[model samples]
Target: MESSTEAYVYYDPTKQNAWVDAILNGLGPNKQRYYKVASLQLVTLLVIVIAKTEYFSAISEVETTSCAVGLMNMIGNKGGCAVRLRLYDSYLCFVVSHLAAFTNNCERRNQDFREIAKRVLFKHQSDPSLAYLSHAWNGGGDEGVAYLAHHGTVLDSSKQASVFHADHLIWLGDLNYRINLSEAEVKQRLAVNNYEELLDYDQLMIERRAGRTFPMFEEGPVEFAPTYKFDAGTDRYDTSAKRRAPSWTDRILWKKPILGREGLTQLNYNNCMAMMLSDHKPVQSVFRAQIRELNRQKQSATRRALQQQLTETPEEMAKGTISSSFIEFDDVQFLEYKEKTLVLENTGQVVAPFYFLAKLDEAQAIPPWLQVSPQQGLLGPGEKILLQFEIMIDASVSAPFNQGQELSHILILRLENAKDFFISIRGNYQRTCFGVPLHLLSPMTIPSVNAEASLTSPPERRKHLLQSAKTTLANPSDPPGSVSPSSSSSSLSTSQQANLPKELWRLLTFLWNKNMLTLPNLFLEHGDRMICDYIRKCLDAGDTFDPSILLGEEEDQTQEAVGANSVIDVLVAFLECLPEPVIPTQFYAEALAASDAPDRIKLLKDKLPPLYRNVLLYITSFLADAIQYAPAAVKQDRRSCIVSLFTVLLRPDLAYKETNPALAQLKKEKLISHLLSIA
Candidate 1:
């Protein structure tokens, strides 16, 4: 009941418009930003967008006072989190909290701290160590929230034992109470309260009575000074005695001296950016300290889990694992493949520690190595050794060094020739997911690789572009059963040659000067079987002609191939043969769809019938797809192609049921079902 999702929650798409409006007005990164931009809608024009990202950790601020110890509640979370970062041999819960109210309900304050601990415990359900990271939140300044006000159970003396006993507790918040308060003054203050609330706010105490949290207190003057101030003159702060000095808010209480058992102890309130971010001047204390119990616990737990995953087989670690380290990387180093350098380390026992590497094509192992490392000494039970190496990498291996360009490869290396060494590196393979043979090091690699040109759209958009080209050539009727020649055939200008593919231009020159519609013979119409057969004859052994051959030739070549006076070639030329752009979008889609060399063959060869069928969907699918398949690349052109395609596909043109119908009607409920059936 304390925390529940409200109806019409943030993700409801039904209220999408309203949500966008609200977000544009105000927004937040909830749950530390795991749920980012789940919805992005353009609410208006002429607006600016700013982006902020939050990664692993977060900081919180709360009000408190009347507490002697500062607190920081280290709640463990599961985004690559852990416990056990050993600081100075002692282990303490990694928690931080502001001072609690020196008030009536000590039990309530204790419960809140417990709740924080529980939260950390729950966040890391799988961690084996004692759960959570907690620290005392303390304060000192009179300007900020007072520690003894409402929830200051942290001060309850009765609960001091358990609080002190907690194994890994760190205190780093404002506490109105001071460690060096005069004994008489401390005694006098306690007299005002009864039983000190048996609840003890007992999470832990500054010092004195303590049980387990921290086994033994680190001797004398360990806890001291007022973490806060009361300066009414500043208006930002108030000055008063009971109103201040005793504030122990910003203190870091550890089992023993943290940095070096013997080190200077001073508080610096300047490390934090105070004037702008917080109303109170933040406090920071540095003890040339070692790690804390909770710190070790968290760190150990996280590293262990990551190491565990690295050792798992792909089948075992199919899903992604935590990568605290990966987040810190600048850019991934993609190494070029080397034969001798590629060695896999074996981690399994009873197997002569196989040191074999894998290739891009092979899932398990390959003949050539992707990586190479000096042989690590044999690792047997209780056998420990570290590797030290220095090898001059030969430029010939990748050629990047030799050629001054880049070369990339996917190679897996196992530690000690282990099974799953370099498992984390697998993600880099997606960059080369498409099965293609890349130049080991192209001579022109550094010439700035560009993206593939956008596919020439189905002639529909610039129907006029082609029409204008067509007009340059004089028209000829079916020359009485053989393409009829136009009176101006002899006068055909150079412009007419510009429109046709090279091969078509040549063949057209030999054919009668007839228009494509009513070729010389009924069998010769552009789409008629005879014309195709004739073209097939020219392309194959006979005449060596086919539809694809025509499509493949360049415009200038086809134009010249289809010269004006031609009799036979004019009737069968490729440029003049394709169905008009008014044809169904699906028809163009098929050509675009099967345009890929392999897919088209598959379609032509019936390799994947559905893809061939799916081709019917796009007049021209996204140009991004084309760039990926091309021998030549064109980047920006592909983006423009995609933008134009989205606009055109949505336009009501020739009806193409196979592809667009599904897209237009694609709702969440029906998408998966339809995708399963088609391309």
Candidate 2:
């Protein structure tokens, strides 16, 4: 066989490739350099069975010249050629072919085309096109049938074939041929081959349906159109159209194919698959041709895989066991190591030795979080070995890979008998603009870069840094380029506090708090501090800010409605968070106060949403703060709104569904009122 070079066409960044590289890297400087020596090799080969079907060829070609496409040409050098692939367990190759004005016409009357198709079918072990097995077209008998030399025949397999059947063929196509068998002719034909209408369209009785054998669909007496069109702007007997005339030059043939055609599919079209790259439509069918033995092998392999998962438990097998303690590595990067830092001391004394085989998580194809080990090997007892590596990553990975997001890759270092030690093999995330840490950007004040030029009206530090940032975002390159990573914290205009959306805002806030507290708090006490901050900021300044600018559209002189369409509801809600006594007067006044400075006005208006939200927060905070000391009227108002807020929380996207204490706070705030209302 003069076969072309085989190419896999798979080069994605999959873990298998990474595993191979890591294994090689872990062999150490000498061994790694030795692999570069090009003599050693590790390889595993697999002949994969896959279903490669034209999943959508049928419906897409509806407006084509034909109904079903059949018998496309096949070209392959030797090796029995190639045929359509199928799933492992199925039987019968079902095909729903569409019609074509030019396709399935047996264009050239010779064995050449049929031979090509047959070769292709046998090579890949697939079945025939659906259209080829339908009722004879154009009054022609089953004379046009084409079957492969070594493959099964027929195309009706998908429809009538039973599970026990090998391949009952079904050829679904626009059979442009009209059948005309007299009572005697029908009997004779029936006797010769089991003849029956593949699929019956009303008004096309075998005898009455007989037409110009070329269009087996309908006759022109009822103004039926011809089953073909060659010229443009021609009149048709069927329906209306421009440019080209209309015709029903489509058809489907039927019979049982030997190979499996389980998920046979179809679509109507003017052309067929024969000329898939042509101006006409094409037919597409799915075929499953499994030798029973092959089917058993594939099924057994699949069952074993599923069973492995179904029967798995950490209690069984080598390498290691589970534990939460961190193993000490004197000189180790933990990420990329050329040696196993964990030398299993006293292997005979210890009862087990295990290591993590793979990471478990719900991550995208290539998550940014990854730790690559550069070296590894079995360690013996009583050896204090040196394993060195670096923690490599960016801030994105260290958004702390938890269990759901990731099952937490605690690199299991198992000492023979001791419980498995888990080290967080997560990337070390570092983020900076130029060289300045993003954390440095967190504080509310920073010095002006141009402080030397203007001292008399020296700009405030936060304002200067903000203006500098605005300038940087606008024009990344400074006219007079300058940068200083050691710069101090800059002031924030309350809301650019974080440009993150509320959902991400919550995450960003957590990250910020983590940087502040250096630990995930016990029972989220930081949440209390956070809510208090929100309340203070909201009551004092939240309402003063304009949400119209931040959350919605900013007015543009040229385009008045060019801003985003957003309601100030969240901002408004923030105002309602404040304590009742201070809110109606203090916060509301703060909200409505006019700012003469446009910048200050924008700033203050922007503060309004947060302020309004804090009104609600403060009310809740007061209940916590005042305990039972609240005034009767104020307490009553809080009681009423708390119930309403709980009802509002039935919605999904808002604050309540959150797992944080905030959601619990909302729920808890309503608990007393909930009982009273129910009572």
The candidate that wins on lDDT is 1
Error of 2 at 498 (Å): 12
Go through the candidates in order and give the clash count of each. Answer: 155, 124
**Decoy 2 TM-score against native:** 0.20
Off by over 4 Å in 2: 1-283, 289-410, 415-428, 432-679
Q: Scored by Cα lDDT, where does model 1 land?
A: 0.28
For candidate 1, the per-residue lDDT at 496 reads 39
Question: For model 2, what is the error of residue 294's alpha carbon versus the real structure, in angstroms, after optimal superposition?
Answer: 12
Error of 2 at 174 (Å): 23
Segments of candidate 1 deviating more than 4 angstroms: 1-94, 103-111, 122-169, 175-225, 228-246, 256-281, 289-679
- The lDDT of each candidate is 0.28, 0.28
Q: Write candidate 2's Cα lDDT for 30-120 as tens digits.
A: 4324221111110111111122133222111111011101111111111111112222322333222222122233222122223323322
TM-score of each: 0.21, 0.20
